[model samples]
Target: MIRIETPLTDETVERLRAGDRVLISGVIYTARDAAHKRMVEALQRGEPPPFDLKGQIIYYVGPTPPKPGQVIGSAGPTTAIRMDKYVEPLLKLGLKGMIGKGYRSPQVKELLVKYKAVYFAAVGGVAVLLAKAIKSSEVIAYEDLGTEAIRRLIVEDFPVIVANDIYGGDIFEEGRRRFARIDL
Candidate 1:
């Protein structure tokens, strides 16, 4: 598995390719639909983003309330398409990585290549398991949005698969082609 940390550098991004298995560490941010909308609006208004986005990774998740001792509750990746429209603004701010489920639009895939960034897929149906990787979590913005609020997270070795890479690789498309080659 390829190991990568936050504040993803351009060199690291250049080497990543679609279908690469990854174990991510260090800091990441959370933002569901609501938080994304707010962030996009902020960018439109020329306001500063809630957090420093330089080379940062954002995970599309809306974590549940944690049990007494845990840092976060079941943290699953949401459908990435929901945040698609808000992506360019973040990308412009130097955001380099994203983790979520679902395929990205073709335009977004091109954007990844244009920005030298990557998108990853965190397996679905593994919410509880995913939460274990989160070492710490705190609401950094849009707290009023509750579960959809933006959060800053310190993660250990979080598992993910590179779904889109700066080289214009798209795992979803490759998977489809592979399946097609296998005559039923």
Candidate 2:
């Protein structure tokens, strides 16, 4: 497994390949549909994003409120495609990695190469299990958006797979190709 600690550099990002298991540590931000929409809109209006996106990773999640003694609850990855339209803008601002469930569009895949970024797939059914890796989380923006608020998370050994790498590698596509025909 490749262990990546952010802020991710171009050299670090280039070394990653699709299908590698990874343990990601350091700070990652959380933003679901609503928060993403707001961020893109802010950019459209010539405003800066809520956080400094340079060399950052954004996890697509809207975590459940922490139960009494927990840092967070059920911090599963959301479907990444829903946030696709919001990606390039963030990438332009120097975002480097994304963690979520599901595959990315072809256009999005192309952009990853153009901008030197990667997409990670977090296991979908293991929300509570994943929350254990997040040492702390705090809402940093859009509190009124409730669960969809942007959160800053400090994680340790957060598990994920490199779903899409900058070289056009896609684990999901490779999986389907590997088993689809049983011919090769």
Q: Which has the greatest TM-score?
A: 1
Q: What are the lDDT figures for the candidates, one per model?
A: 0.95, 0.96
For model 2, residues 73-139, the per-residue Cα lDDT tens digits are 8999999999999999999999999999999999999999999999999999999999999999999
Error of 2 at 11 (Å): 0.6
Q: Give me candidate 1's TM-score against the actual structure.
A: 0.98
For model 1, the superposed segments whose C-alpha errors exceed 4 Å read none
Clash pairs for candidate 1: none
Give candidate 1's error at residue 175 in angstroms: 0.6
RMSD of each: 0.6, 1.3
- Candidate 1, residue 90: CA error in Å? 0.7
Estimate the lDDT of model 1: 0.95
Cα lDDT, model 1, residue 11 = 95
| Candidate 1 C-alpha lDDT tens digits along 51-75 | 9999999999999999999999999
- Off-target runs (Cα >4 Å) in candidate 2 are none
